[model samples]
Target: MNIWESHRFGKRIHLTYHALRRMEERRISLDMVQDLIEKGTLIHKDEKYCWIFKSYSHRDDNLVCAAVIRGSAVVIKTLMTHWQEQPE
Candidate 1:
């Protein structure tokens, strides 16, 4: 897990290592994800199961993230159906 900071409205946010890598590889910002999370625009999985991470970008590039589910976290490139199997 990466360092997380809670926003004023109680949203957990941080620069994912993957996001940082993306920044280094290309150039993206976690700001979009942060904004969506803050505004509650991004609804990932329910709190009972999974929590989704968000990333923002000026370029039309795929956003990736890492998440801890069950007891492990892995890097993910897409959230489309069946993509969870890659992490599995």
Candidate 2:
């Protein structure tokens, strides 16, 4: 399998330091993010990254994240607890 596909199947995933900080600040648990990587949809993909999102509606907002998967790692580039617009 390809690296990204391997990651989706629970291969070793290393988060960047920035990603770790962002997850903590956003109160996003590692398990939550991991689940997204494993089961989230690939919303967008560029030459260097793949964006995966797992969205859930809570109250009037959406709890979601746009993760940038590069190589064998998933980096949480943007996370929103009450997202309004579709993640890019």
Candidate 3:
């Protein structure tokens, strides 16, 4: 688990154990996660979860996203790459 107190956003963000493992497997760095949380587009949200997306120039997987649970402390559940927007 990893915790970041984001002064810019005024919230504590936690990367859960599962999220950490996924991040490593996906080759997603901590800095990328931070940027996603801070600047990514909010593509979906419900009462408890939010999906944030962003496009990066460095990778073949241009779009990456993060699944996060919203609360006093935002918990990042997972990270994904090569994300495609599904038809609603």
In Å, residue 80's CA in model 2 sits off its true spot by 4.4
- Arranged by TM-score, best first: 3, 2, 1
Q: lDDT by residue for model 2 over 20-67, one digit each (tens)?
A: 677777777776776667777776567556656667443233455555
Prediction 3 TM-score vs. true: 0.88
Q: Rank the candidates by lDDT, best first.
A: 3, 2, 1
lDDT tens readout by residue for model 1, 2-60: 33454533434445455556545554344544443344323345443343444444445
lDDT for model 2, on a 0 to 1 scale?
0.58
For candidate 3, the per-residue lDDT at 36 reads 89
Off by over 4 Å in 2: 1-11, 57-61, 72-88
1-88, model 3: which lDDT tens digit per residue? 3898865458899998988998999899999999888888876567788788899999898689888887888888988998876777
TM-score per model over all chains: 0.36, 0.62, 0.88
Error of 1 at 30 (Å): 4.4
lDDT of each: 0.38, 0.58, 0.85
* Model 3 alpha-carbon miss at residue 16, Å: 0.9
Error of 2 at 65 (Å): 1.7
